[model samples]
Target chain A: MPRHAPIELEKFVPYQLSIVSNTVSEDIAREYRERFDLGTTEWRVMAVLARYDGDGLSARAVARLTAMDKVAISRALARLVANGRVLRRTHRGDKRRSVLRLSAEGWRIHDVVAPLARQHERAFLERLDADEQRALARILDKLLATDAAVR
Target chain B: MPRHAPIELEKFVPYQLSIVSNTVSEDIAREYRERFDLGTTEWRVMAVLARYDGDGLSARAVARLTAMDKVAISRALARLVANGRVLRRTHRGDKRRSVLRLSAEGWRIHDVVAPLARQHERAFLERLDADEQRALARILDKLLATDAAVR
Candidate 1:
């Protein structure tokens, strides 16, 4: 008789974490839709440009910040371009590479979303006191920085 | 001049954690692709059923376990049924409700994946030490158990 397979539901920490995260993200996406009329990726792009500093990173930086795929970011940026939420301009001396920036509407969206995002965060982290939230963020960032551990 | 958008990234601890979780899940998905012939959902479904009771839950339960949508799970279970990875049968009294259980091959796949999933988790959580892993798991489970906090 073969051994009974282990229960994966509670055993895999990563899967559990992902489940919680996805649930939280879906809530955020739904809330964002209600407030901003933007897709998840579109809002993510604007959020990235809100952090943009004329670094010419385009969709690459957005993906880095949001943990989205390059293809997904590219598609989101294309939509932004179509909707005039983002602008793509030639770099000062580089033709092949284009620098992407937020347009006026993108800024408007970001402005509207920032406070709501903060409130959402507050609601989600309400169970955790400030110190606990800070501690969790520190630990998560440390884990994220350790490539060998995660890789 | 438009006002500079507020910091979107720093506003939410849960949002940041979700992005970190996405990073880890993507890493796990990449690892699975390199080692298994199964797609992401296929691997997840098998894993979900590995520990599930043979009493057979509805496809919705499986979807919740796998974090997959009902339509997607519908399609995947259809494929799994055709491939003999799963047994989809209606209850004796109720034919409209389909109950799902793992077939032998599904069990085999689950056996193969358990260690791989654990390896990925052990490596990722190694940074936090065993005690910290337990702590993190407890906190995450608490959050997940809170229905309003989840999504």
Candidate 2:
């Protein structure tokens, strides 16, 4: 019988990345859900809008920037719009199209949530020494750039 | 007016981690979906079962091992069982509860998929030098351990 070596899920880089990302994301998502009744996708859209501020992004632009599925982004946008967290307006540049931005309420949430998100990131980074933190950031950049090149 | 700095999404650690993880996972998932018609959760459950091999794991055990939602795990198990890729038998230690293991077909799929998964990991790691690779692994361990401690 040929010996098949089992892949150790714990040591698997991709699996580890997934778990770590999911954990961090879930923790942040929990805060958003509990405090603001925002789902993961919705909060992500809000975050992008918060970043863009006055320069509203099209749904297509949001999808591209976030690298999220179009359908998921659309759904999140709908929920946000319905709940009055996001405002959709006709694009001034293109009358045929629309763009999305956070409402005053949305900015209020983003102002609070963005800082909280930063706090969580700081807490996570504090576990590592300065060297490890630098390495992690550099490694992620390389990996992300490489992945982006392929896509 | 006090200016609130907009988080540079591109530089944000958590957002970068998420985008990288999602890209890698989505790429791998595309392969699995195309080749084996497997969902991410299903492949994850299969990987866990393949690791255990003969000693089957209960659904709850699989959930714990994967750190996945119980509902998602259950749904994946159902799909696997329905597709005849996994076998569910009453636990030997406790007759009331059931345990899951890969069937012969499941093992066949695992044998093929495991190597493919390793290939993807290797390809991703090839972008980094030896030091970067080692640093990434160590950094992930630290981050994962710290995150785990909180939960």
Candidate 3:
């Protein structure tokens, strides 16, 4: 047995979301890429690291938080470390696990980028009303929760 | 003086949208990849072509519609044609421009996959209420419209 359904590519939620997200991300990435010399992957890793006031996160934790694979995280960390933006430390008790945190320079860059990121988000979101904004948030939250549950 | 604003990566709309969209896309892609042996790019081209009941579209039009790069569209189209899922025609008046349409086999694949895609969307949306669904749609529309306007 076969079933058929009409689907418009433009109206598909996943398609729409991918286009908008990619556009917004590329737009936002330009500033970071040009001025900060950071790629999106590096910025993502830095974003996670910037949040912790103290004590760095393990690579596994960063992977879990960012939804990026270990290879990407490792590559970004290498670049950040080489740029002197991220500081890597080995836990005293565990030699096997490495912890990562933003260096003073990393924090400095984060401080500069975070507000700009928010401003971009605010500007993009300005197209919608406050109610729409709230609803969007609620819907995303529900989707994320459900996605997690399904996985 | 430099201005600073606190930003939470998890709460950021762009980040959230990106994560959710990527997750949904990957989840949906698995079924098509496994069952139909079609990549995301190939599926996208086929989806667009399936909508046209008659005259086919050029690769450029497909790129515009799908937001995919020329190289990807070319590669996907090549694969689809090779797999006997797509038929290419040279217009009688214009020999230079080639038109693309799904083969009967392509339509069969689309008939099978489209329902699965809609089902995924439905299942994902089931977590949100009717109001939330409407609001999400409205918000996405506004964002998309604004994005197009700005571009």
Candidate 4:
């Protein structure tokens, strides 16, 4: 009987991707967590809100955009709302639905943290040369699109 | 005043990597979670142990190999030990540390699940062409190496 080859975790693409993603995430999370006391889900919520600054977004929309779990997003939103970092207002078009936006304080933090986040990304990408960076971007896009189509 | 550009989450590399990683992870998690009642960390621990069959590893070693948090690894180890899927034994050379390995039942499950895990990985990678796969492998390697050097 031919024995099956054992998986080398280091060589496994999914495992490698998870490690790389988590490392990048944890580094960024540390930056905001230390200064702003924000968790990963909370910062993600704030980021989406900051991008749609004026229009705001519903909790569902935020969850969709971030690709985060609804329960995690809900908990993050509740904490942000409670802490005055986010403002929740009834949607103009739908009375039952509400939209969330960064409060002035949230925007202030976003402005500071957004640049730091971008800087972190730039530093990480700098490890790869121009050609490698482009390849990574294209590969990620292809993988994401394929996964979406599969689902 | 010139306005600063907000991060387009869809275009951001880290954000994109995160979404892709999480989607892949969640899909695989669903498979094992339903069939084996395994959480992500538990499965990760099991995978590492399975890879190093016969030679048990310390929890610290598992954490380092898996790049998971020590606390999370500890919790998973506790649960696996309690469930009899893993056996904890005293180290031959170092009495202070206990080494962990999969039990007979653990190997039984690993044999079934590892192939499924590899299949999922292969299906995901098949989405990209051969060139794209090579490029992704190189890029991920560079990123992981860079991260290791930085830390």
Report the number of the highest-TM-score candidate. 3
Report the C-alpha lDDT of model 1 over A21-72, residue by residue, as the tens digit.
Answer: 7776777788878876678878877877878656656566678877678899
True contacts kept of 2: 0.75
Q: Per candidate, chain B TM-score?
A: 0.76, 0.94, 0.92, 0.93
Q: Over the stretch A24-124, how does candidate 2's per-residue lDDT look in tens digits?
A: 87788899899999998888888888777667889988887777889999999999999999999998869966789889898888889888989988987
lDDT of 2 by residue, B1-151 (tens): 4455566778888889988888777778899899999999999899999887767889998898888889999899999999999999998768877788899999899998989999988988889999999999999988888778877
Model 3, B1-151: lDDT tens per residue?
Answer: 4243546888999898898989888889998999989999999998888875468899888898888899999999999999999999897898987889888888889898998999988877777888888887887788888888888
Q: After aligning candidate 2 to the native by TM-score, how far in Å is the CA of B146 from where it should be? A: 1.9
Q: Give the clash count for each candidate.
A: 0, 0, 0, 0
In candidate 3 the C-alpha lDDT for residue A89 amounts to 88
TM-score per prediction, in order, is: 0.83, 0.90, 0.94, 0.90
Q: Give lDDT tens digits, candidate 4, residues B74-106.
A: 999999999899999999989977799899888
Each prediction's whole-model lDDT (CA):
0.74, 0.87, 0.86, 0.87
Cα displacement (Å) at residue A50, model 4: 2.6
Order candidates by TM-score, high to low. 3, 2, 4, 1
Instruction: Give the CA lDDT, 0 to 100, for residue A137 in model 3.
Output: 85
| Top candidate, metric DockQ | 2
What class would a CAPRI assessor give candidate 4's docking?
Answer: medium
Interface RMSD of each: 2.2, 1.3, 1.8, 1.5
Misplaced by over 4 Å in model 4 are A1-4, B1-4
List ranges where model 3 is wrong by over 4 Å: A1-6, B1-6
